[model samples]
Target: MRHLFTIALVSLLLAPPAQAQNDVRFQVLGGDEALRDALIAASRLQAVTDEEDSASQDIVAAARSDYARLLAVLYEQGYFGPDISITLNGREVAGMSPFDRITQVRSAAITVEPGRAFRLGRAVIAPLAPGTDLPEGFRSGAPAGTVILRETTEAGIMGWRTQGHATADVGNQQITARHNEAELDAEITLAPGPVYRFGTLIPRGEERMRTRRVLRIAGLPTGEVYDPDEVDRAADRLRDTGVFTSVGFTEIPNPDGTLDVQAELVEAPLRRVGFGAEIQSQDGLTVSGYWLHRNLFGGAERLRFDAEISDIGAQNSGIDGFVSGLFSRPADLTPDTTLELGFRIEHLDEPTFVEDTASINIGLEHQFSDELTATAGVFARYSDVSDNFSERSVWMVGLPLGLTWDSRDNAFDAASGWYADATLTPFTAFEDGGGVRATADLRAYYGFGEEDSTRLAGRLQLGTVDGGDIAALPPDWLFYSGGSGTVRGQDHQSLGAMQNGVQTGGRSFAGASFEIRQDLFGNFGAVAFYDVGYVSEGAYGEGASDWHSGAGLGLRYDTPIGPIRLDIATPVSGDGTGEDVHLYLGIGQNF
Candidate 1:
């Protein structure tokens, strides 16, 4: 009887015989649909390429793997529980097989309910224990109920830790939902502790290169109160030296709560070489190359050599070719003096004349203080010209002496600052046709902004040349304008006095330009500007009437090299025959 019972049980267990046992299939449901949705979501997230069939196939494969994991979880959660009943489209499927059951078990639709986003309610900071050297007022004015509160708390705690308060921490802050979904109220509390003072500063590697000069530029001071902003500023100063490949600062907390600041600096390559080229629509194709030895002869001296060749195009006046040589020495050589010397050669091809010229200039610049610098220079040029109409060869010499004062915080970028510069040149005739000439130039810039990036900039320039009378002036003594740098919306060198198709006269020019710079997206910026100027022969008389004005819009790309500029300008007042719209592409701010 027992044997007979066992045989019957085994037959029943084999189960092709019972309907309930046949329903136990493990179906691979949710795999296909979940995989499809996941793939679509990933493609949207990463902007996957759909044009490639192979890429789509790969995504599908990946999605399949992901969905397999989800299906495994469902299986583990008893989707095939003891009371399992597999159905498709409301019809029962008869099976106990794993594959058929899984195929019939589809994923249930998911629904999400909207939840309120919490707003910041309050923030509280606590001071470190007594004998600590942390600065006070370190955690003040932090807005309550702000998403940034958490980040600010973390930053504050980190700041305290850097000041030798290793045990410093931020207390819990809470956010409460407001009646208005979008509005938030902020609460803040301060917990600045004792002032942390620096203990020591250590220097290493190439001591000659890490001398006082380097230390001064490094911007770290021993015995000063500890502040994160100070530490960051020091790091920035060191990096700005351009002599360090890596820089790091570490603070060690002592038993007595004092802080020891240690800085580690890695020397950059002492020597470097670079080459570059550019093609300008107006200046034509140009090639430039340069080599630099940052630490020439050691002791952090910089030596550089550069060369450039510009091919003048049809849009340019007379000048067809140019070459220049320059040398510079740092101000540390003479306490506050920086010296530079340069030589240039230019080829001029006018409609009626061809000329070759060479010039040499020497300049001495001295920084009276951090906010004031003075420059004085002397330049001499010799030119040989063949008159097109006169059919005569003419030789002339020119000498210019000038002084400049620059106090602007940023030479290339000034949003809320003021700078003024003036130059004077007195000329003497050295040849038969030579006559006395004098020229004066002045410029000023003013900025108005609470910060450096957002501000209004105003600029003014005035230039005048006099040689007793207009006709007595040398051709080279006259002022010329018309380009993005001068009066836009016109041709290059197409302004000033003209006589018989040549600028044989001298004139005075006065102009003012205003620009408002606003930050746009990321590193990009936008600028709107208006420039007004006039060129006249008479110094201040009614006859000095030729004046023109232009307005323009510009886009600035803050590139690593400089700010790349694209400007479109229209002549507000002009002859109207010139190009109505002028476009410019170049590096650096226009000022």
Candidate 2:
């Protein structure tokens, strides 16, 4: 449509001038406010309005182009009949002969008198399949817009395609404009080919991956009715497996009412290595690295190894180290399920205690659907932990079960949707006793206004360990709130159970946070948030009810990976010395 207007403008712009002139201006005269504004917006004259030394021919060309664009826009807006005139300086475009020459030009004018808008006089679409989704404006007596008419045609074809018809399209279309009655008559015919079922899938670009596995991963249900959504999903599954850098699927025409599927794949690099580092006010320097093998054991299985070391600042000496190895087998028992195996080792020396642990777990994660997943596993751990008051070594075995429901549109900047997760782990201390640990977390997000620029996000977490001795358990198993992950105004794990003037992880924990986010200009945005947390040595009860709160403001810069956050908060109320403010830096939202 725009190209058509440009062509018209080129023909209208015929300037016989000797010298070039600048200082172009634009004006919209005589039309309805909305229509006149639309024409002005459609005009291209304003693009070169600041060209002070433009040639006379340039100004004339600009005006002519503006007139052409304005006319198209007027018609598309349902105004088939409109009076349009383009004037350069004081000379009318029609009055200037082909031989007339100009030396200088200053002003340009576009006058549009858009008449009454045309309505849909007689709208008819033949062979429109039942349940076809269409625009409301495509009906008779509604405003006749060119865009709407095109959308109506597309909707009709899509309707047939949804009902197993793979080759459905608009066979013919006729749109007649009537200037006498200010109306438009539209007629469309559609052709839907025979219903198609799924056929055999042929694979290509399979260098490292086996063709049979590729077909299995695609998981296309053969003999089922054809659906474009299904084809797209199969391709998406191939892409999400991490084994493929690129994936494509094409439909081949076949006989017997079936569409043959052709799969094209690009295998990702077999091995990858990367590293990262971060610095914080309280935690010093943290460095980390990882290695990955996408097709470790074939069948799109992944193997990974990672290591991290932290607390390396000049002033701080409480350093920590961690290492882990992970493996996952895709499509283990079901297409959307995976078998995962993991082993981890960590050494921690904090203000509260010194702790070391080695843990291993084997789990099966089944994706029930796009929004939900369930994981069940058995884990074993051996840990030696000591604090100022006590020290202990323990061996523990546990059964872990977890479920998560996530509907957030974007992980970094979620404007709408809710997420919830729950985990229950029952453990037996080999030489001491037995206990049960349970936790549930809920997060919700909602946006207001256009494009969801303003959003409200919130989270609530609850946890408890019922029978284990708090001093004997692994430090990581216990909960402590106060950090970028929880209340930001306080130091890391600074608001936990107090023992002999030192902070210690608690068996019972609760934390909640709320944020109001508003995007500013470009990639910048601002947020106001409040967070509260409670931790105690005993399970959640009256005696364990010491809650600390923090309220503050934050700034965020959006990135493809996530949002970079800088939250500066002050303790609203809690175990703090006077008014201590803290600044926390990280990626992604606080949650």
Best candidate according to TM-score:
2
CA displacement after TM-score superposition, residue 329 of candidate 1 (Å): 5.4
Model 1 stretches astray by more than 4 angstroms: 1-114, 117-148, 151-194, 198-200, 203-213, 224-230, 252-261, 266-286, 320-478, 498-507, 511-533, 538-543, 548-591
Question: Per-residue alpha-carbon lDDT of model 1 for 159-189, expressed as tens digits?
Answer: 6656644445545444333535422333433
- Model 2, span 243-297: residue lDDT tens: 9988888887587888889988889889999876655666667789999999876
Off by over 4 Å in 2: 1-77, 82-114, 124-133, 136-138, 271-273, 313-317, 449-451, 498-503, 536-543
Q: How many clashing pairs per prediction, in order?
A: 24, 5
Candidate 1: worst-modelled 10 consecutive residues by lDDT: 17-26
Best by lDDT: 2
What TM-score does candidate 2 get on C-alpha atoms?
A: 0.82
lDDT of each: 0.53, 0.80
